[model samples]
Target: MTSFRLHKAAALVVVIIALAIGSTAPVTARDSSSTSKHVAKRIALMTSQKAAMDMLTGMAAGRSTFDRSQARAARKQLIRSTGSIRKHFRKPHLDPRSNAQPLIWHAWKDFKARAGTAEAAAKDLNTGSLSGLRRTLPGLMQSCLSCHETYRSTPNSFTTH
Candidate 1:
């Protein structure tokens, strides 16, 4: 098969993997009640960011076709989501369901700086072409992973669903 077809097949496989990894459903109302409004909003914001990242990463990794419009949209979503990180976590709201670590509140300045780094990375992402995405997406992903490593609590199974 052609490169495009291979990428398409890979994209399908990625989607299947995402579903198998429990990305198919949002937290139910019962779960929502376990967390505060601030915590819930923060979780939602992170979820949105994750979705956009998944799309962009799939393209950058040659697992999906590079559609400029879709890439741009994902980039935009990331920018917005990163911009909101501070607002969402402004309060030290915590709940059993929240994955945010206490260190995030203790090291507030560092957390904000990391959020700023993520925002900058989102703004820096270039969706102009596949090459641009391959070049810039890793930085953005790294920023996210850096913050998560320091601030996010380890999930029991890496699934929110």
Candidate 2:
């Protein structure tokens, strides 16, 4: 049982990256429309990540409360959506794509290791006990953050001013 803190840290990094992009505040004169299917793919990735983030928050809250049923439900959503979340990443880049530094594929084995950590965290989450989740989610979030650091830019990392 790895520490949930690690996972929590990872997830936070990704969340920060997502925030940096905001997926709002449209860029100027980029002609995003001019792009082919890649633009659509990026949009889908954004949506997918947002949904997953929402679900993960719920799971995190449920963790401390020992809400087994809630944990179970969250795990189910995660199991269904994890592939799509990963799928979103498996495409050509466009629209900044969260400052993904490209080292993700460059160090594919390390990337896979992070993914594996997330998978274990997910399994621990399936235990469906708030205590189990509380015990696990931190590490899970950490795993998420570690990977995102290499793949994305921290959201709101800079100010418009």
Candidate 3:
């Protein structure tokens, strides 16, 4: 398979693994401290997402050169960060964490589906074509909205869901 195909397949696998990790295990860490636990994970996610957005934006502004090595590095880091968030959702808790509503767990299937879309779009971004990344980034952003509408954060409040 070409790199494009490999990226796409890898993304799909990541999504599948994320769902399985989040859906199968019960969250065993539900407590008043749950908020902090979630905060840490959210912070990690926000940091990683920020980096990913920055790199992709480089493509848009003609700042990032589209090299296969850079794409692979960025994608690998994203996978690690996202996978961390996904595992946080699992881990045995009676209730969901801060920045995470019970709604996400309740609608696990739909959530996973939308996340997969974002992943696939990211794969398209890594397909070794700057033009392709430019065209596809918006679609991935929309896919992200699929979840954000339901899960919004209030800065450090960690109380908004």
Instruction: Please provide, for model 1 over 1-161, each residue's C-alpha lDDT reduced to its tens digit, 9 standing for 90 to 100.
Output: 23354345434433443454463343422343424445655665766677788899899998999999999988888898798889878888876456789988899999999999999999999999999999999899889888878888763322444
Q: What is the C-alpha RMSD of each candidate to the true structure, in Å?
A: 9.5, 9.2, 11.0
Which stretches of candidate 1 lie above 4 Å from their native place?
1-35, 155-161
TM-score, candidate 3, is 0.57
Predicted model with the maximum lDDT: 1
- Between candidates 2 and 3, which one is better according to lDDT? 3
Superposed by TM-score, candidate 2 places the C-alpha of residue 6 at a distance from the truth, in angstroms, of 28
lDDT: the better of candidates 1 and 2: 1
Clashes of each: 0, 27, 5
Q: What's the TM-score of every candidate structure?
A: 0.76, 0.56, 0.57
lDDT of each: 0.75, 0.51, 0.53
**Model with the higher TM-score, candidate 2 or 3:** 3
**What ordering of candidates by TM-score runs from best to worst?**
1, 3, 2
Q: Per-residue alpha-carbon lDDT of model 2 for 1-161, expressed as tens digits? A: 12253244434444554566565743522324433234344344434434554555665675333455655666664554443445545554545433455666677667666666666666666445545665666665666566666655653322211
Q: Roughly what TM-score does model 1 have, to 2 decimal places?
A: 0.76
